[model samples]
Each structure stands twice: as structure tokens, then as C-alpha cells.
Target: MSLAETGISDAPLILGSHTLRSRLIVGTGKYDTLELMQQSLEASGSECVTVAVRRERLYDPTGRNLLDYIDFHRYTLLPNTAGCYNAKDAVRTAKLGREILLGLENPGADWVKLEVLADTKTLLPDPVETVLACEQLVELGFQVLCYTTDDPVIAKRLKQVGATAVMPAGSPIGSGQGILNPNNIRICLEYLKGEDPDYPVIVDAGVGTASDVAFAMELGVDGVLLNTAIAHARDPVRMAHAMRHATEAGRLAFQSGRIPRRLYASASSPEDGVIGRTRQDRTSQ
Candidate 1:
């Protein structure tokens, strides 16, 4: 089904001071070519896309850059501190991202996808470093959207440190495990929202398919941020489109509310139907 058919009214747009059209946030890594990346972005209807800044090969004389493929005007460029190991590196990378991508005038980047991985193999956020970086970033005037574990304490700490959003991983990055710890994630959501109803809880990473996206939303997650799932799909464009609709459907479902489950069977038939009749009617024999 189309995104419009999924009951996604245009009213509830996920914005960062300045409005972003699409709620689905995508990543710029893993696409075969620039054209493919553009196609996936168009197909996914993602208004916000991520770009990692670090020492890498450049296609031009201007050293390493992402400017060639990315059009900042078209998509909200969410530069991420993907490879940073400590608070110092994450903070430094964020500052550079602001300077190179956001420019000096827009120093208040308004949003940053904060990631401080402790281990290169697992790509898990180091709680100690992440919290330190979050505190520093928020103090620096950037709206921090931290990528963290599905631990209530960690999430709460991040929230206490002024993180605008806490993005807990469904599983390891690129693993496609899809909410490995739903109970923990739910607890995190409850803790943050209960503490401050306005805090945004986003599920980031390890979402494999549409169901995974729906599950996150069903659990009351505000939004989701993903990359490898779509980019590595056999048909990236199709997967992107699917993810777009899925996110909308999930959001709609959350707003619509769900029915509580019961132990015994409940009939939808009329209360005074034949099934409800007593044994007296069959005693003619």
C-alpha cells in the first residue's frame, strides 16, 4: 500500500526546528553507486539522510568529502559520529561536521546522530564515553540524538544529560536482529516517556524488514533510523519503498491504539444469536 493509504496524515511531520518532509531517515552508505543512492532516497521518501565524516578517500582535489553525492538542500543531512571511540573524537568529528557541512551560520546544527563505539568489532556504544560526549554536545548547543543500548539506566542517563532523543539499537549494527531485547527497549521507552512525555525514543539499527519497523512503532517508539537493511537488500529501491510504507503504517497503528488480549474466546456475533441459546431449545427429542 502507498504511504498515504497508511493513514499517515501530513500533519505530524518529524522536524528539527525546521520541518523535514519525510519521517523516514536513511543512510548514505552501502549503495553501489551515487545514482543508486539517489534512487533509494527517492524511493524511500526519506527527508533526512545520514553521512559519516572521517578520514577517507576523496574523489576530488578537496581531500575526503561527501558533498559530491549529497545535496544538502534536498535532504536534511544528518552527519554521524559513527567511528568515534571516545568523547574527544566524537566531539571533534561533530564540530568538523558542523563546519564542513552545516557552515558557520548554522552552528546550531539542531540535530546530531551521536555514536561512540567502544569496540570496532561489535560497534556497540561505550556507555561511559557516550554519556560524556552527550553532555558535552548538549552543552555545545547541538540537539543530540544518541545511539545507545536498550538499557533503561543508560537511556535515562542520556535523557538526564539533555539528549533530545535516545536511539537504542534493536540489535548490533548491520546484524538485522530486529528488536532482540523488546522488553528492555519497552522499559527504556516507558522510563524516558514516563519521566518526560516529550522525550523522543527512536529505534536505530538492526531492523531487517517491515515487521521489524512495525514492531518498534507498536512499542511506542517515536521513529527509526536505519541504513544497512535497505542498502543491502537485493532490491534496494523496493526495500526502501517498503520501509517507507511500513514506518507510516506502524506510526498510524500506534496512534490508533490496539485492543487488549483476553484469555478466553470472545465472539463477534450478536449476543442473542443461536450460539447463545440454552439447551432447552434442543430438548424436543
Candidate 2:
């Protein structure tokens, strides 16, 4: 049988109106070179990539931009309000990105990765401003995928505000600490998917390695959006491949169901099934 026949074919990730095959979303920054970024993205097998819409980020110091390296046709661009500190700037940046993508006729024109930071040091979301921007952007006909903290209540509030996808940070952005509190992440998953089971809740940021992605997936997150984890790796291209496979493995393990954790050991082979071992002898042991 073909590999796909062995149950590798799973349901696609659904975010609002977009049905995507790749559950991993990468970012378009931090690579040693633009070429490495392009290759790493290809290796990642991601359908969507987040791009910071800041002018400096949009254009490299060499005067060229992501448009020069990234093929918009091959990858859908999810424009993000990376540096925006408040609702107004975030909204404006989202609009500007929409305009740019609309001109390019890209599929991501109407959707965004909304990030409204509280400060540069922490890179945490301003919960108040995040909700405000989400509401405003939704009103403007943009599919806003909000970025927020791992607080379950805040996640629910973002969903209530009409966020297409609620992305909770795995930890601090680029901190590489992975999922610091799986319990909180579990709660966030429970709260967000409780009402709408299939609602897309992606874990964004703080992934350091492939296992981090797999761990987040095992927690039942719909997807993962990461950059530094892959881009800043010693071997970025190889790590990208690892992240792709990790996503698939994690999703498959979740679907297949795992054994419950136990303090005691359970043998794969039963004592009764052992040759030359009588029931009385086994019992005596």
C-alpha cells in the first residue's frame, strides 16, 4: 500500500474560509540570507507564512523586499502587525497589508496575523488592544487571526471578538522555552474549542525545536506558527524538514490515541501468554 494508504492522509486545517493542508505556519524573517529563508520555507512544507508589514521589514537594507525572494504564488502571505503597539497602528498596518496583497492578487489579501504588542522587551500582546484591533479588523472585512497570551479567558474573549483564529503564545516570543505551562495551554484549548470544536486555535511563538511543535500539536492545537525555532536553527533547512514531519507525527499520534499515563509499568507481553508458564506458576510469582 502507498504511504498515504496507511492513514497518513488526515483532515486539512480550516481557518475561517481557508482550508489548508499544512498545519505548520512559518515566518519570513531571521534567516542568514533571503535564499536560505526561501529554501527553509520550502522545506517546511507550509502553505502560509507570516510577514511583518513594517516598511523596514518589507524592504531589506538592499532596497529589495520579500517580493523579490518569496513567490506569492507558492506561499500565501499572512501579513502581521508585528511592531504595532496599539489598536490604531495595528489596524492601519493590516489595511496597508491588505492593499499590498490585493494589488498582488494574493489569496491572503483578506486575512492577517494580528499582533499588538504591549512592549518590545516582553513582546507580549496588549490584551486590551488586541481585542480592540480584532474587533476593528473584523469590522473592516479582514479575517483576523489574533495573537494573545496563554490565558484561557483572554483566548475566549478574542474568539468572542470574531477572531478567525486565536493564537496563544507557547511562551514569550523567540524565548525558545517551549510550552511552559501545558496546563494553561490545555485550558485554552478547552475554552476555545469547547463551543466550536473545530475552531482553529494555533500555538504561536516560543518554539525552539521540532519536538516543541510536536508537543503543542499533542495538546490538540489546530496549528503552530513559528519563526525563530526554524530560522535561527544551526541547520535551518534541515530543521524546517524536521518541523514538518513533527507536525504530521504529532497529529497522527493524537488521532491514533495514546495510552493513559500511569505510575506503574505495563508489559507488552502478558505473563499468561508466556510459553511453559502455567497459570498457577505465574500466580505464585
Q: What is the C-alpha RMSD of each candidate to the true structure, in Å?
A: 3.4, 2.2
> Which candidate gets the maximum lDDT versus the true structure?
2
Clashing pairs in 2: none
Off by over 4 Å in 2: 1-7, 56-62, 273-281
TM-score of 1: 0.88
Taken over the whole model, the C-alpha lDDT of each candidate is 0.84, 0.92
Tell me the deviation in Å of residue 245 in model 2: 0.5
Please give, for residues 145-174, the per-residue lDDT of candidate 2 as tens digits.
999999999999999989999999999999
Off by over 4 Å in 1: 1-18, 56-65, 104-108, 269-285
Across 59-135, the per-residue lDDT of candidate 1 in tens digits comes to 66774345666667677778799999999999999988877665724323567899999898899889999999999
Instruction: Locate the minimum summed-lDDT window of 10 residues in model 2.
Output: 54-63
